[model samples]
Target: MLLLVHAALTFMLVGLILMVQWVHYPLFAQVGAATWPAYEREHQNRITFLVGPLMLAELLSAAWLTLHPPPALPSWSVWLGLVLTLLIWVSTALVQSPLHGRLSAAFDARLHRQLVVGNWFRTLVWLLRGGLCLWWLTLLL
Candidate 1:
C-alpha cells in the first residue's frame, strides 16, 4: 500500500515537473514587465497550493519506503529514491526559490533563463524517481 502511494505521487510529480520545465517556466518571459510581479506572485501562490501537499506526501512516503521497503524492491533503489527526493528539495530551496524571489521583485531576462535551465535538475530527478517507481511496480507483477 505504501509503495503504491509513493509510486503514484512520484509519477504525478514527474508529470507536473515536465509541464513546468517545458511550458510554464518558458512562458514567464512573455508576461509584460509591468504585470510580471503580480503574475509571478500569483503563480507562486497557486503553484504552492498544488505542489505543497504533494511534496509533503512524497517526502513522507519516500521516507517510509526507505525505512521499510517492500520485499521485492531492492534496498538500493529505495535509497536512491530518497536521495533523489533530497536533491529535488535542495534544488527547490537553493536554486528555484531564489530565482522565483528575484522574478517576484522584478522580471529579469537572465534570471528567467536561469530558472528555466535550473529547473531541468528537478525535472530530471523526478523523471528518474518515476522510473524507479515503475521498476518497483513491475517487480510486483
Candidate 2:
C-alpha cells in the first residue's frame, strides 16, 4: 500500500514536471516578444499558485520514501534518487529561480541567454528523472 502510494505520487509529480518544462517553460520563454510583461506577471502567479505546491508535494513524497524506505529497492538506487531530488532543488535555486527573478525585472538578450542555459538544467533534470523512473520500474518488475 505504501509502495503504491509512493508510486502514484511519483508519477503525478513526474507528469507535473513534464508539463511545466514542455508547456509552461516554453510558453514563458516565447512570450518575451509579444506579451513579455503580461507573461511575466501571470507566469509568476502560476509558479506561486501551481508549481510551488506541486514541487512541495514531490519533495514530501520523496521524504516519505526516504523515511519509510522501500523494500527490495537497492540502496544505490535510493541514493541516486535522493541525489536526483537534490539536483532538482539545487538547479531550481541556482538556475531556474534566478532566471525567473531576472525575467521579472527586465527582458533582454541576457535573459534570453539565461533562459537558454537554464533550460539545460530542466532538460538534464528531466532526463535524470526519466532514468530514475525506469530504474523505479525495473525495481517494481
Candidate 3:
C-alpha cells in the first residue's frame, strides 16, 4: 500500500516537473519586467503550496521504502530510489531554488536560461524516480 502511494506521488511529480520544465519555465520571460518580481513571488509561493506536500510525501515514502524494502525486490532498487529522491532534494535546494530566488528578485535573461537548464536535471531525476517506482510496483504485483 505504501509503495502504491509512493508510485502515485512520484508519477504526479514527474508530470508536474515536465510541465514546469517545458511549458512554464519558458513562459517566464513573457511576464514582462514591470511585474516580473511580483509574478515570480507568486510563483514561488503558489508553487510551494502545490508541490511541497507532494515532494515531502515522496521523500518520506522513499525513505520508508528504503528502510523496509520488499522481499521480492532487488536490494539495489530501493537504495536507488532513495538516492534519486535525495538527488532531487539536493538539486532543488542547491541549484534550482537559488535560481528561482535570483529570478524572483528580477528577471535576468541569463538566469532565466540557467533556471530552465538547471531544472532539466530535476525533471530527469523525477522521471527516473517515476520509472523506479513503476518497476517496484511491477515487481510487487
Each candidate's lDDT (Cα)? 0.93, 0.68, 0.92
* By lDDT: ranked, best first: 1, 3, 2
Cα RMSD (angstroms) for every candidate in the order listed: 0.6, 2.6, 0.7
TM agreement with the true structure for every prediction:
0.98, 0.77, 0.98
List of clashing residue pairs for candidate 3: none
Winner by TM-score: 1
**How much is the lDDT of residue 132 in candidate 2?**
73
Comparison by lDDT, 1 against 3, better one: 1
Q: Candidate 2, which segments miss by more than 4 Å at Cα? A: 16-34
Return the lDDT, model 3, position 13.
Answer: 97
Q: What would you estimate as the lDDT of candidate 3?
A: 0.92
Instruction: Identify the candidate with maximal lDDT.
Output: 1
RMSD over all Cα atoms, model 3: 0.7
RMSD of model 2 against the true structure? 2.6
Error at 121, model 2, angstroms:
1.9
Tens digits of per-residue lDDT, candidate 3, 70-119, equal: 79888898999999999999999999898898788889999999999989
User: By the lDDT metric, which is better: model 1 or model 2?
Assistant: 1
Q: After superposition, how far is residue 75 of candidate 2 from its true place, in Å?
A: 1.7
